[model samples]
Target: MTAVIAEEDINRIRWHCRRGMLELDMVLARFLEEHADRLTAPQWQEFERLVSLEDHALWQRITATSVTDSTVERLLRGCIIC
Candidate 1:
């Protein structure tokens, strides 16, 4: 069974979703609104990793403008923004 994400964790992730780029911010926000509550622990970890990336790197992954790590790539593919 998937573990429930903690409220504190969700809030933290929500804050991290705010990006320097407006386009990136919009995409991440939409993904969070639609999927944050349902993310499994592993997915949360992957998402945290994704958010930790520099803005350009994260945007590249979202836009498929450059190659990304497979795990993050997979997660991006599942997001509504992708």
Candidate 2:
């Protein structure tokens, strides 16, 4: 909660990341909580790009089951253990 993200910004991102799927919500929210504070501007841009994806596509990239792009996959590699 103490990340550089202002309250409004966090809320906006939270809203965007809030998916109907519980698993998606948890993983994305947790990533924001744990890593948001340390993210550089470029990382934030990448994250915004990732979150903008549809739930299924984002899940695919995060899980590596059907990676469409190596760049996004690489960005999330460290955050996702699977």
Candidate 3:
């Protein structure tokens, strides 16, 4: 079964996707628009963890300069920047 995320949670995630960098914002926004509804439970958890990261760290992951959890890695790979 698909993981069900509450609308409020999705909204919260969207808000957090707003980063200090424009590129990060665009990349994350694209990812959410394309895949938020399709994430599994563990993926959702990893996504939350990802958004909690500082902008630079998150950006590093987006640019493939740093690696993180596999689930987060896979999710980010779906992003256009990856």
Candidate 4:
């Protein structure tokens, strides 16, 4: 059976994805640039697989969350793979 992700875990992942570290930010930036048109099916699938989430759900959470006060180190704490 697939493990059910808790709300807290989702939040933590979102937080990390947004504010983890400079390296992560760079990676995400490159991803966004390369996928600007969202036309690459394989890249889209890979991104979803990497995050262990569906695209729509992940985008919704990312768009809804605010990262005004989070720091790289703080977010990194939450990114640890249990």
Candidate 5:
């Protein structure tokens, strides 16, 4: 991502990905752990933005209750198949 991800930042991102929702946590944490280093700068930034969302809002996007912004959806599309 930003000049290629550092191990330290990857760990930090992993911690931040521990979300209030278990489903979100699993999806995000695993995704970051597996691919944070491989992400583009935009993807990394978008992921940070995605994780910043509160639990209910995040869940709505994950569960399709709300057809929300595309940033989160695009990032998630790789990990989640609809």
Candidate 6:
């Protein structure tokens, strides 16, 4: 059965996507595409809302991060101070 997605959920997803988290963006994309057919009316609405955000705002959010770390650094250092 299709699941209903609320507008708030879409906003949250959009926020995450704008944050420039590759992992999160990919996850959300996969989820929406996979369940496209099964989405309820509300779910579809939420998805549409996500698509309506300004490109600049989305880009800024997606790229903004508290700390900058390279992929290799994360893999090897593992975010450990010690």
Candidate number with greatest lDDT: 3
- What TM-score fits each model? 0.77, 0.73, 0.84, 0.33, 0.70, 0.33
Worst 10 residues of 5 by lDDT: 73-82
Which pairs clash (backbone N, Cα, C closer than 3 Å) in model 3?
Answer: none
Off by over 4 Å in 1: 65-82
Candidate topping TM-score: 3
| Tens digits of lDDT, candidate 5, 22-46 | 7787778656656665677777777
lDDT for each candidate structure: 0.75, 0.72, 0.81, 0.42, 0.69, 0.47
For model 2, residues 1-82, the per-residue Cα lDDT tens digits are: 1226577876888899999777788788778777777776666777888889998988877877554554435646556644
Clashing pairs in 5: none
- Which is better, 1 or 3, measured by TM-score? 3
Segments of candidate 2 deviating more than 4 angstroms: 1-4, 65-82
Tens digits of per-residue lDDT for model 3, 1-82 = 4699999999989999888988888888888888888888988888889889999988777678456568666667667563
Off by over 4 Å in 4: 1-16, 53-82
What digit string (tens of lDDT, one per residue) describes model 4 on residues 21-64? 45445544544444324324444344445445444554443344
Q: Which stretches of candidate 6 lie over 4 Å from their true place?
A: 1-29, 56-82
lDDT at position 31, candidate 1? 78
For model 5, the local distance difference test gives 0.69
> Which 10-residue window of candidate 6 scores lowest in summed lDDT?
72-81
Backbone collisions counted per model: 0, 0, 0, 0, 0, 5
The alpha-carbon deviation from the true structure for residue 9 of candidate 6, after best TM-score superposition, in angstroms, is: 21
